[model samples]
Each structure stands twice: as structure tokens, then as C-alpha cells.
Target: MRFPSLVSGEFVKRINRFVCVVRIKDKEHFAYLRNTGRLSELLKEGTCVYLKEKDKGKYSYELLLAEGEKGILVCLDSQIAPKLYAEGLPAGELVYEPKVVGGKLDLLVGKELIEVKSVNLVRDGIALFPDAPTQRGSRHIDLLIKAYPKYTPKMVFVIQREDAYAFSPNREMDPIFANKLKVFKSLGHRVVAYNCKVSLEEIKLKEEVEVLWR
Candidate 1:
């Protein structure tokens, strides 16, 4: 899972509405950014970045894919999907056969296939997920277990570390996500959540981040 289009060594500005950011070097005084979700990480007020040249655009800039670990996170996602197929535990398998629990799942990972989600709301000491109600998200955990007969299913919630020192679901915002997590655990397939590391040199994101259940 290599990074598709990447920008290296540029000054980053705010990324409102999923914009791309880059530096023009000798000619301009402003940052260059594009409009695409492909750019990893939410563009913030002052994102550090560089540039990857592409065919000319109207704005003369290519999207700045997150470098370092963000790039790795993209790679990890594609790689893990297949690796899970190969090193599957009883609970994990690469069901190339593919199952459509409802009408939404992209891949059914083992017994508890999950839909990947990125969370982006954080402030003060709290982090919020979905930022909107997710009908599919709630259904995903439910289907994970429904797809299985013997064991519980799992939902992998991956988040990047921001300002907070700890992590938990934004129960107040998406109470259903939290409630469903509890239900899943009661059924057996516990909801697993983990954070990706972000920095200047590397970004390794994971649908699964190992941690203590307690």
C-alpha cells in the first residue's frame, strides 16, 4: 500500500473542507492545496508539508498526501486487509469469498468484518467521532456478530493521536456507537480501538492498535 500522490517538505496551512496544501518555492508566497479526501490527516491551521509534482491543475497544485506515518497508515490498511487473509486467527480470516452483511460492508474481516472509519473531532480534553450520526457504523458491529454463529464479532475503530492523553468513544455525541460497543462485548466480539502515530518522519495507521482490554 504505497502512497499514491505525495508532497514532501512544504509548509501546511489550514485544511478546511479537505483541501490540499503545498509550497511553491521560488515563485509564490502562499501554500498550495487541493480539494480531496486523499490527503491524509485533517488539514490543520499550520500543517508541515512538501510537494509531489503532478500534471498541471487549474490552481497549479497537486494534493499533499500525508507524509511519513500517514503514508504508512494508507499502506498498512491495504496490506493488513490481505495479511489478515493469510495470518487469520480463528476470529480473523481473509474471506475473499466476501460477504454482504447488509448493503454496506466493503470487506468482511474474519468473523467480525468491519467498515473502516476515520475520526476527526477533538478539542479540550475530549474527542468526538462520526461528527455526524452513522447508521452504517452502528449496523457494522451488529452485522459482525450476525455473520458469525459461534463467537462475537468486532469493530476496529482507528484514530490518530491528537491533543488528548487518553481515548474513548464520544458517547455523548454518538451514544449508539458506545451502546453498540457494549452490546458487541456482551455478545463476545469486543469493540477494539487504537490510535495511529503521526509525526515528521513516519505515520503508521492501523485499523487495529494493540492495547489492554482493561
Candidate 2:
């Protein structure tokens, strides 16, 4: 994703509550804004960080991290994921629209009108998505199935982090999603789990990664 006013400088301090204040000059202060792609460890109290400054916030906008600094966007999936489809195999006919029969979708991949879920919770080489309960996640499966009776639309839980070989639903936290995913498999629709190699630079959709299914 492209961000405006990318700040390539050093980290000064995390001022206020969420603002990561940086020094571009003597009187210039650059605060790290909260955005989607920004990670926790990337912004240290005294670490060199690249950011994008936006004027859309009263106090701050967000900092878009450059992946090249850490090379997190290199693989996207399968740096730790199992093996499903190949990476960079060409997103042929993979439509990018949001339309579900019973509900709404996130994006479309060809005949697969799918929903994309981004998980940020990671621990010891494992990352789980939907840190909280998602009634919508459980419902997406039903909607996808209804959208394509001939072929079940795929619902991909895209884990957007690093150092994981597989992906799993947060059954303990959201058993509804887990149970629905387990039940949905009988319909012959695809439930894909993939990991994203993220950085301050870019977040890519990778192929040739591994997946775990019930």
C-alpha cells in the first residue's frame, strides 16, 4: 500500500499515549500514527523507523512502515505456513469485488468470491486471528456457501505477521468461528489459511504456502 509523506528517520520517543514522536529537525516533531500495517516492535523508544506523516488526525494520522527495512513482504505466505497453492502463480481471473449471496464479502479471487481476515495476535511462532469474538466471521462461511452453490466460495483467514507455519481459528476465544469452519468443510468449499510476511514497506498476497483444515 502507498502512503503519503513517508518519514525515514530516527525514533525519539513515544510521546502522549499513542503518538511516537520523532525528530526530523530541531523544532520539527514527527509522531507515528496508528495505521493497519504498522507493527508494535517496529516502533521502539530509540529505534530508527521509517514512517508516513498524514495531516488527517487532530493529534496524529498513522505511520506506514517500509517493508524493505525488514523484508517482511518478501514471502507474504509460507515463510512458516504449510503448503497449499503455489505463490506468485498469477491471480488469473481473480476478481477483486465484494459480493456475497447471503452477506457481503471482502474480495474476490476468480470463481472464489472470498473474505480476507487479518490477524495480529502472535505468540512463539504462531499467530491467531480475530483476537475478539466475530459474529461476522462465523456468518461469512454461510454467505460464501450461499453465494456459490455450484462451488463453495473460499474464505481465507490471512494471518498478517511472521514466523508461522500454519494458521488456526481462535477456537478458545471464538469457538463459533471454529465450529462453523469445521462444519463448512463438509460442503466441499475451500477454507484457506495463509501467513503474511509484513514490514514497513509492503504487504503482499503470496502463493505456494501451507494451510491447515479440518
Candidate 3:
């Protein structure tokens, strides 16, 4: 997807899950962070970030992407995951924010329920999810497991960056979520991971890659 007018900025500090401070053209401003994930590794002090002007939102600007290690651009917004997934997936009537047993699933295409996760953390060419702990993520998987007999469950990991060689669950950070993923896969559900070709112009879904558990 193509972003709006994005200006470069320096990330100062994150005030909370939704707000962050950034310096654009040497002027400080408050920016809205769309994702709630702990981005300690991605959004650091003095890190280069991309911000888009927001006239109707709570903040003046919204954070779009950030420059991580090795000049990689990581999309900070998690909402892009489901949108890209629905667009790239096979043709079907996509139900956004489908109500589930415990909570709302990301998308429901026909009889298939899919959960989309945006991945930005990568180490040694291996992409990982939930850079921090995610009990809600674990709950989603558990709920999916309970609803398996009636619906086809699938988990999609959308790596925001292009350089990741492979994708894996971050067991070190959230063991329960990782274990639940393993169980969900073992139950014959699908676990898919795909990378995106991200640039300043657009972010499009690329090819599907294998999901690495180890």
C-alpha cells in the first residue's frame, strides 16, 4: 500500500503504546503510533522514522515506517497486515474483524478464519513475531483451536521488511504464544509467513516463505 505524504524524522521517545515523540526538520512533534507492540529494537533514540501528516486524527502526524539495522524499513502500523493479507489472498468475501469465541479474528474468508500479524523483528536473517510478550495473541490461537471443528483456522505472519531470509515464532520472548502456534499447526491448521517488498513509494506483498519453528 502507498502511504500519504511522509516526512523523515528522528524518533525521540515513545510516551505510551499509542503516542510517541519525533523530531521532524529539527522541530519536535507528537506522532501517533498505530501498533501497540513493544518496539524497543526498532524505534530507538535518534533512529530515522517516517511520519505522515494527520489532520483528522488525535495527533498531528502518524508514524509510518522506521529505519532499523542495515537500512531496512519496518512498517510500524499493524493494521496493514490484515489489509495486505485480504488483498493478496485468493478471491473470497473477506469479513474484517470477524467476531470469534474469545475475541475478533482478523479476517474471515469464506469458512476460513485467518489471523494476521505484522512482523518487524529480525535477527540473523530470521524474522520473529511479538518482539514483546503477547497474551492476547496466545488467546487468539487458543480460541482458534477451540473453533477448529467448525472453521478452518490459519495464521499469517506478514514480515514488514524485505531482507528476512525466514520467519519464526519468537519463543524466547513469548513461549506460550510460540507453543500455541506449534499446537495450532500440529492440529492441521495452516501457518503461513510472507515477506513484503517495502519502499518509500509502496509496500506490496511478495512471495510466501516457509515458517520456521526452531
Q: Candidate 3, clashing residue pairs?
A: none
Q: Pick the candidate with the highest TM-score.
A: 3
TM-score of each: 0.55, 0.62, 0.96
Task: Give candidate 1's whole-model lDDT.
Answer: 0.46
Preferred candidate (TM-score higher): 1 or 2: 2
Indicate whether candidate 1 or candidate 2 has the larger lDDT. 2
Quote the RMSD, in angstroms, for model 2.
6.5
Off by over 4 Å in 1: 1-5, 8-97, 109-112, 121-128, 150-152, 161-165, 199-202, 205-214
lDDT of 3 at 70: 82
lDDT digits (tens) for residues 134-178 of candidate 3: 998998898788778788999999999888878999999999999
The top-ranked prediction according to lDDT is 3
lDDT of 1 by residue, 77-164 (tens): 2223322322333434545435565544544554445554554344453434555566666777676667667333556555544333
Residue lDDT tens for model 2, 1-214: 3224455555666665456666554434656444332344444555555555566766443444423233442222212221122233346655444555655666565555666666555545555655667787778777876786644477666565555666777677778888888777777777776666455555544432355543
